[model samples]
Target chain A: MSNMPTESQHARGQTEPSHGAVRTHVISFAIMIVLTVVAFVMVGAGMAPWIVVPVILALAVIQVGLQLYDFMHLNQRGHSFPAFFITSGALLGLIFIVVLVLWP
Target chain B: MEAQPRLVNAADRMELGLETSTLEGRNKVLGFWVFLGGECALFASLFATYLTLRGQTLNGPTAKELFHLPLVGVATLFLLTSSLTGVLGINAMHQGRRRSLLRWLGVTVLLGLAFLAVQVVEFITYVGEGFGFSTSAFSSAFYALVGFHGGHVAFGVIWISILMLQLKKSGITARKAPKVFIASLYWHFVDVVWVFIFTVVYLMGIMGI
Candidate 1:
C-alpha cells in the first residue's frame, strides 16, 4: 500500500488550508443561480409543455452534475468509483420511477 | 500546498481514533448513502400517491390556478443558496476555519428559515383561497410534496444548530469533521429534492397539470 495520501484522502483531508475550494464553490453557485433563472423564465413563458419539461429537467440534471463534479470533487482519482456508483444508483432509481409512473 | 503542519498534527492525533471508531468517515459516507436510498423509497411512495390523486381537485383551485411561478422562484433561490452555504461550511471545516464554518452554517440555517417562512406564507395564502389539507387531492399532494420538503428544512435547522454547538465546544476536530460532512450531505440531498419539487410541483403545476 502506498504511504502517500490518495485524492479522496485529500478531499477529506482535514487541517489543510485550501480555501481556494470556497472560490470554486462560489462560482458553481453563481452558475446554478443563472441556470435556475433561465429555467424559471423558460417555463414561465408559456412554452410548449413538452419542450419546457425536458428543458427544465435537463437544467436540473446539469445543476446536479455541477454539484457532483465541482463542489463534491468527485472527479478526484479515488473518488470516481464511489461517484460512479452513486450516479448509477440514482439513474436506475429515476428509470424505475418513469417506468412505474409514466410508462404505458 | 504550503507545508500542512496543522493537517499533519490533526492526522497524527486522528489515526488513533480512526482505528477505534466503528463509524469513521468512510462508514459515515456509505451509511448516509444507504439512508438516502431509503429516502428515495419514501419519495417514490409519495410520488405514486401524487400521481394517483393529482387531478381530484374537488371544487378547489387546481395546480394551474394556485402555483405562482414568481413566488416559487424566490423560494427555490433561498433553498438552493442555503445548499451553497452548507457547501461553504463544509469547506470551512475542511480548512479548519472554525469561524468561517460557523458563519457559513449560520447563513445556511438562516436561508433555510427564510425558505420555510416563504413556504408558510404560500400555504397560508393557498388556504385562505379555500385550499386546505383535506380540500382536494391536489391540495393533499401539494401539501405532501411541499410540506415534506418544509419539514426537511425544519429538521436541517435543528441539525445544524446542534452542529453549531458542537463547533463551539470542539472546533473542527476529526470527530466533528465527519458530523459536518454528513450534515452537508443531508443539506445537498434536501437541495436535490427541491430541484425535483421545483420541476414537478411548481413548473409542472403551472403547465396546467
Candidate 2:
C-alpha cells in the first residue's frame, strides 16, 4: 500500500496529460463517429441483411474495443484486474445469451 | 492496517491524480469494476430474453413497424458524444482542473438527459401506436431491455448531477476523485451497452430480422 504512489507515478509518469494524450482522445472520438456513421449509412441504404447484419455487428465490436481501450483507459497499466473482471463478465454474458437463445 | 502518519498533506501527494493516490481510492475503483462486471451479465440475460421473444409479436406492432432509425440514430449520437465528454472530464480531473471537469460533466449530464427525453418520446409514440408493454411478448421484452438501459441513463444523469454539486462544493479532492471516476466508468459502460442496443435492437429490428 505504501509503495502504491511510486508504482502509479512510474505508470502514469505525470499528473498532467500531454498534448498527445488529448489528441489521442480526439482522434478516438473521430473514429467512433466514423464507425457509427458507416453503420447507420449501410443499414439506411437498404443493404442486404446478410451483409449489413454481420458488418454492423463487427463494427459494433470494434467501436466497443475503442471505448474499452481508449475512452475507458483499459489500455493503461495497472488495469489488469479491471480488465479481467470486465472481460470475464462480458464473456460470461455472451455465453449465457448464446446458450439460452440457441437451446431455448 | 495501522494509519500511516502523514508526512505531507493528502492533496500534495496526488501525483497520479487524487483517485489513485490513496489505497482506499484504488480499492473503490477496483470494487466498482467488479460491480460493472456483474452488470454485464445482468444486461446480457435481458438481451437474451429479448432476442428469443422478439419474434413472438402475436398480431402486435413488430420491431420493423415500431423502430425509427433517424430518431434512434440521433439518440445514439447524443449518448456517444456524452461518452466523449465524460472521458474529457476525467482528463480534466487528472490535470487538477476542477472547473473543466465540472463543465465537461455538465455537458455529459445534459446529453444523457437529451437521450432519455428522446427515449421517452419514442416510448410514448409507440404506445400511441398500440405498442404498449403488454401488447405482446415482443413488446414486453423490448421495453424490458431498452427501458432498463434508459433507466440506467436516467440514474447516471441523476448521479452525475449530484456529483457535480459535490465537486462544486469540494473542488475535486482525493475522496471526490474516485467518485467522479467511478461515475464516469458507469457512464461509459452505459454507452457501451447502447452500442449493442442500437446495433442489435434498433438496426436489426429495422431490418425486420
Best by DockQ: 2
Candidate 1 chain B TM? Answer: 0.88
| Alpha-carbon runs more than 4 Å astray in model 1 | A1-17, A80-85, B1-23
Per-residue error (Å), model 1, residue B82: 1.0
lDDT (tens digit, per residue) of candidate 1 on B109-191: 99999999999999999999999999988789879977887898899899999989988998776557767777787888788
| Candidate 2 ranges beyond 4 A from true positions | A1-15, B1-16
CA-based DockQ, model 2: 0.47
Q: Chain B TM-score per candidate, please.
A: 0.88, 0.92
Write down the TM-score of every candidate: 0.84, 0.92
Model 1: interface root-mean-square deviation in Å = 6.3
Candidate-wise lDDT, in order: 0.75, 0.89
lDDT for B124 (candidate 1): 96
Please compute DockQ, using alpha carbons, for every candidate against the native two-chain complex: 0.31, 0.47
